[model samples]
Target: MSRARSDPDRKLRKAKGRTASSARWLERQLNDPYVKQAKADGYRSRAAYKLIELDERFGVLKRASRVVDLGIAPGGWSQVVRKLRPKAAIVGIDLLETEPIEGVTIFQMDFMADEAPAALSQALDGDPDLVLSDMAANTVGHKQTDHLRTMGLVEAAAWFAIETLAPGGAFVAKVLAGGTDADLLGLLKKHFRAVKHAKPPASRKGSSEWYVVAQDFKGRE
Candidate 1:
């Protein structure tokens, strides 16, 4: 096992103070137990624990289920899905390239474009059991603009989920915390039996991002 797997907290503390910004980030990592545990568990990113926590709370993943992962660069979320359901077919798509991961098919494409969802559906070969979007727009230093941009991606992902989700499928996407998501939540409530928002432990404490999980697709459209 790697040293990070054995002494994650020590590694985080040692990583502190290399640079002004890095010092603060390291302090946060050291204080976050999830980050330490993720290092010890050999996961690629701390984001993996968010998926694990969400699944534990929602009972989302299942053996042999088909799962779609959006914005899956760096492969952490995909790694979690693969570990949880070894028999499941997993497909991941992102604008940036991702290194090959065992048992995952990755497509480098901008999913916000019109043609992306069709390409993703073609790759899946059938409807997916679960669709997960951990996508966020690159921060432009304007809070309102950033929120709108992120919401656009979330809405697009939700629309694609409506198109390709299996009858009883589930969709989960990241959203900003403020009241900006009310309209989108209303739309989701119409199509899903239950919809709830969650802030997983692995996420940064100061981040505006939260996840909206919509379960039991009703196929309204």
Candidate 2:
């Protein structure tokens, strides 16, 4: 068994200049099994496991040849894609700078920018077989406002997938606890053959995060 699989729980001592919240977060990271596993497995972030689990359950990566990864900072999801689909052509965009990955084209630009869509489409050079989005708007602490903000990004990602995905393509994106809202859900159902909501095991139990997987794009009719 891997060391990560056998490691015992750990705690961190409080440090100077650390806020209570920061200290708690550090302690949680210290004890998170997924964090240990990510270090052991050479993944940049624990989030890679989330994509792994989702793909295992949904088979999202099986047929993917060209992939678009939105909000690809730290490049964990892209790393997962490259590992699972070594021959896939991947293009990713994010507001934050991301370290280069072996098989991915990274663009450090805001996905909300007008030129972003054209840039990604051009880079892929073909309609993507899979579009993955792990975007969330920065929170302002108000629950309702935060939900709406993140949903806006999710909506944008869904529309991008619908517009640029090949027939039978798949879209997977992160959504909050309530899942996709009514209007967005309706849009996904209209464009895809199947739509489902999932909370992967890698996500924290206290987290509001969930995933919306839409598969079998019906073509632009």
Candidate 3:
């Protein structure tokens, strides 16, 4: 395990145009150990550590041969997948443009589009053994609305995984801190042998994000 160095907390001077919120965010980033470790480890964002921790606990990547990455902007999660499973076929989609990563087929489009799932499945050429979603809807500053939108994306991703995953495949997705809603949980329980939720240490203590891991797909019979 990489440890955070004992550096002093960095405080940025209040600039002419920086808002208080932005300044606080900047300071938080400056002081975050995971952020610093991500830079040193050549990962794209601190989020890479969250996936690493989750995988360490769940072994989600160990046996994956083909993978789909949803919400792959900045390409951090896919980068981890590439490094951990060098031979796995990887396909990723995001509304935001992502710089190309070797061994990853990226499509800069909304995952909710009617044709998006087919495109991902076609690119992989077979059912994926692992599906990862780090997607979150753009917050409209309303907590309830934000949660609903994000959960909707999660539900869509779950359906994609259910529809296309190979038997015994795994699905991992980001959810709100209260965890997967009742309907989604019931859906996963119906199709997977195991369903669990985890909040990795790399996630900020103040953040309301959690991850749901569903494995051992029962297949679409």
TM-score of each model, paired residue for residue: 0.87, 0.96, 0.98
Tens digit of per-residue lDDT, candidate 2, span 147-177: 9999999999999999999999999999999
Clashing pairs in 1: none
Q: For all candidates, what are the clash counts? A: 0, 0, 0
Residue 61 displacement in candidate 2 (angstroms):
0.2
Best by lDDT: 3
Q: Which 10 consecutive residues of model 2 have the lowest summed lDDT?
A: 1-10
- Model 1 bad stretches (over 4 Å): 1-19
Give the TM-score comparing model 2 with the true structure, all chains together: 0.96
Query: Whose TM-score is greatest here?
Result: 3
Residue 44, model 1: Cα distance from true site in angstroms: 0.8
User: What TM-score, to 2 decimals, does candidate 1 have?
Assistant: 0.87
lDDT of each: 0.83, 0.94, 0.95
lDDT of 3 by residue, 1-221 (tens): 58577357567887999999999888888888888888899989999988999999999999999999999999999999999999999999999999999999999999999999999999999999999999999999999999999999999999999999999999999999899999999999999999999999989999999999999999998
